[model samples]
Target: MDDKEMLFNSGILTEEREGAILPPEELWKNKKGGLVVVECPQRIPCNPCATSCPTGAIRPFSDINDTPSVDHSKCTGCTLCVASCPGLACFVIDLTFSDDLALYKLPYEMLPLPVKGEKVLCLDREGKCIAEGTVENITQPRKDRTYVIHVSAPKNLVREFRAIRVVK
Candidate 1:
């Protein structure tokens, strides 16, 4: 089946679909802080990602069902939207973290939160363990319960790493 068909049938975003929503190459590659990546493919009636953007990088929606359109130039990668997205589709990738590693900030709501410097099992879109990663930081906004977990993993796996499991 085609990527879109598989995505619709399985609810796991294919590489093509995910790439389609990514910020421009130059902007995401050259931007210092990082860039916000909204993986929300379905056009549902949701606006938290857009409304929570402090820089207006996630453009205001014309309709409630509009998918997020990011203006990468204005994005500071503060990750406020990551914390606010109920669907947990938002992420931030910082390629400048290291030569061999990329920093990924993902929305995590699971209990027994991992701590900084803890080793973790990096998971892909299907919740399958793909690689080992380290928890660099975990930000829990007082207002929102959704925690944003910062992880560092191999740069080559940037497209594959989505979520993490706390290793026992």
Candidate 2:
């Protein structure tokens, strides 16, 4: 099956879909604080990601059903869109955190939120644990109840790391 077909059959994003939405190579390679990565490939009627952006990094959609497009240059990586997105497709990756580690700000809505400095099992897009990560921080600027979990894991796993499970 084609990448798009596989994505529809299973919720997991194919490499092709992921590559299409990624920021430019130069921006990904050099940006410091963080960069928003929108994984919403389907042209669904969603605009919260674009509207919630404080820096207008996520450009206004020409059509309501159009997929989000980011002007990486304008993105401050504020992560406001992370909680606003209903599909949970938004993530902020900070590669400059350390030489060996990268920080990921992921949307978490599950019960019993993980605390700061807690150890968590870093899971991939498939929800499989691939590595252990440390919870650097947790922020909820709005009372929407969606918490943004800041997880720091090995820099090499930045692309694979997505969600976290509190280590028991």
Q: Which has the greatest TM-score?
A: 1
Q: What is the per-residue lDDT of model 1 for residues 1-168, given as tens digits with 9 covering 90 to 100?
A: 998799889989997876787778887776776898888888899999998898999999999999898888999989899999999999999988988988999999888999999999999999999999999999975275589999999988777788999977
Best model number under lDDT: 1
For model 1, state the Cα shift of residue 107 in Å: 0.6
TM-score of each: 0.95, 0.94
What overall lDDT goes with each candidate model? Answer: 0.88, 0.87
Once fitted onto the true fold, the runs of candidate 2 whose alpha carbons sit more than 4 angstroms away are none
Q: Residue 80's C-alpha lDDT in candidate 2?
A: 91
Put down candidate 2 lDDT per residue, 77-131, tens digits, no spaces.
7889988898989999988888888899999998798888899999999999999
In candidate 2, residue 84 scores what lDDT?
87
- Clashing residue pairs for model 2: none
Model 1 residue 109 CA deviation (Å) reads 0.3
Listing every candidate in turn, what is its Cα RMSD in Å to the true structure after a full C-alpha superposition?
Answer: 1.2, 1.3
Query: Model 2 Cα displacement at 141 (Å)?
Result: 2.7
